[model samples]
Target: MTTAREVLDRCDALAACSDAPERLDRAHLTPALARAHGLVAGWMAEAGLRTWRDQAGNLCGRTEGREPGLPALLLGSHLDTVPDAGRYDGMLGVLLGIAVAQRLRDEVPTWPCALEVVGFTDEEGARFGTALMGSRALAGTWDDAWWDLRDASGTTVAQAARDFGLDPGLVGTAARRPQDLVAYLEAHIEQGPLLEAADRSLGVVTTIAGARRFLVEVVGEARHAGGTPYPRRRDALVGAAEAIVLVERTVRGSDAIATVGRIEVEPGAVNVIPGRAVFTVDLRAATDDARDAMRDTLLAGIAQVCAARGLGMRVTDLYEAPATPCADRLRDALRAGVVATGDAAPLDVWSRAGHDGMAVSAVTDVGMLFVRCHDGISHHPAEAVREVDVAAALDAFTAAVRTVGATAGSGATVRSGATVGSGA
Candidate 1:
């Protein structure tokens, strides 16, 4: 009974909880995130589910199945966003989940698996620069080194967690066992032009691209900008600029997707010769082998660029995720969902963009439903989706849930002895 209009309004409501008054800029472990959670938790509770904030900062809610304490078939998406992001990318999926909760609030005979939704805290990594922290933690893939990672304001993850009322020592307790999750279903915007060009309302995701991120540093001696002669000076910014050109030129017409999104230079004085330049690289490809091969060539090219510039070079890896293929069983359910929406056959597409499903795949099967956005615009202010398309997507998503739920043993939690969502 939840209309698409309500979902859009809710997204706008969440968008208002941003750090900047001028633009939408919500990030992880911030006051803005706390406010967003407070709003969403209420929505989840009103939809007939018990809600809680997981130790990893993910907002979660669930309702029991035919009996109490069944393993969960998960739904929902991240709530974080990039700077000045379009509201629908992650927000729509979450609001849709709440709609689904409303749709099934009074189940005549509750399905085998419990229904749970999670609004992940940090999928964009816009704040910490390391994406999928929330999903990875839920998948039991926590990295201790992340505690040392700092934000632009030099706030450590531990301090931020404490500031957000989370205990660092107990962060590990957020992990959910493999047996505790039956599956994870994420409905998201296509974030590309293909769906729109094809004139489709929805599509099925076959795989998610593998991505590797690195911070490459070019070091040079700092000297007086005016006094230092051209031959004597080693300008890091210049060196980094040259290397970044190589990054673009190398992947210009290739199947791989590469970007140098962020760069920073040392020496605050504008007149001072730059001593160090650190730039972030986000490299992704359809397959792991292709991605790695392209990375090897690209890094070698960067190293050569630094050597030619007579600069010290260091490459520090920020993150890496292997290409994740959708589970066939889950994919089938999604396909069936799309078919039920009057699409005789669903267009199967591989995602060029990264998703939290990549991290969650380790814990349970993962599948995605991609709704077409206006011209595939995302991460920008103009991102958009149609109400009719959303309504269709909702119908398909509900059918997919039933399709998977039907496979569960009669009155059983998991097919095996697995216990789904046994976490607090």
Candidate 2:
């Protein structure tokens, strides 16, 4: 049996493998990532699995089943962290997968399918501004342009891969064919307050929200604040403020979330009307069509604001990922796991935050189990998960895997890349 205390201690140990001494900041392919890789690989070997680093620098461990060449049942998550990250987040899922594999190894050394865990190198997009590099490669969706993506110090991803002793040309080898696996399972923190608000420790994820991001720039002529009268002034910042308000209002009217996470205004002088205003819009919804509709409405609203203020506006699409739904079979399995913990009815919530599960889902049916975190805080130092919740999560996660195995044996066909319900 894996105790929550033991798992929490492991989380603390992995937290030490960080670039910052006072905070957690492990980026992709850095020395700190290599150190973390060593630690996780050692633990995976201790759990009776053969461990190796994939072509894309994803750390993988595999334990064979009754037959040596069985399609693997993938389990794990990323090991990278955002700047000043908490101890858990992506790290907890990897540790929990290891513990589950260890427990199952003790119970049933050889099962129907191989159990594999992968600690993806990059999922935070902290260093290169592109998330799910590891999982995307495994899903056979590696974009060639990503090789040119640079870090803050101007190091290309290809160069960093070389520095990390990996060949960029071989990244495609990381991909697994759709028929090469049973299914993908990830256990992650809810990263929200829903479970805690509902007073539950665990929940099955219904879907992960799709996201479309944009870089919006509002351009206007700069003028002296004191010299330019209010009637004659055309401040880009003012126009941007109005546009932001419109964006908020438009998104609020729909079942979507919109945020202006970052903004910058030109003309350093306090006595100058801004010539340029730039900001980022992160828009998310349960479905692609809904998200696109909200985006169009928000853009039209921003254009109106700019037009009325005599400003020129430009919008650049940064990224777009469609919503992903959990498979019905896996959801049923997770529900059974929750019931095994005495929760007859588990809350099913939508994930606003993105995960590697999103990328992996492109190649296979993906399922996610969520454990409650304190106050829904994530990507910060204050993020915390309770010990009791983790214990229950461990129990539930292990049971979920068992249920998946049982379903596979019962001739319940689970086709790869198939979903239980329509994504909305």
Off by over 4 Å in 2: 106-110, 409-412, 416-424
lDDT of each: 0.87, 0.88
Predicted model with the maximum lDDT: 2
Clashing pairs in 1: 180-419, 180-420, 180-421
lDDT of 2: 0.88
Best by TM-score: 2
Compared with the true structure, what per-residue lDDT tens digits does model 1 show for residues 1-424? 8888888889889999898889999999999999999999999998988999988899999988887766688898999899999999898999898888878888613677678899998899988878889998898898989888999999988899999999989888889877777888899999999889988899999889998989999998889999999999888999999999999999987888899999989995889999999999999988899889998998899889888878999989988889988777778888998999899989998899988899888877788999999988999999999988898899999888877764554433232335532221
**Worst lDDT 10-window in candidate 1:** 415-424
lDDT of 2 at 355: 91
Q: Which stretches of candidate 1 lie over 4 Å from their true place?
A: 215-250, 262-280, 299-316, 409-424
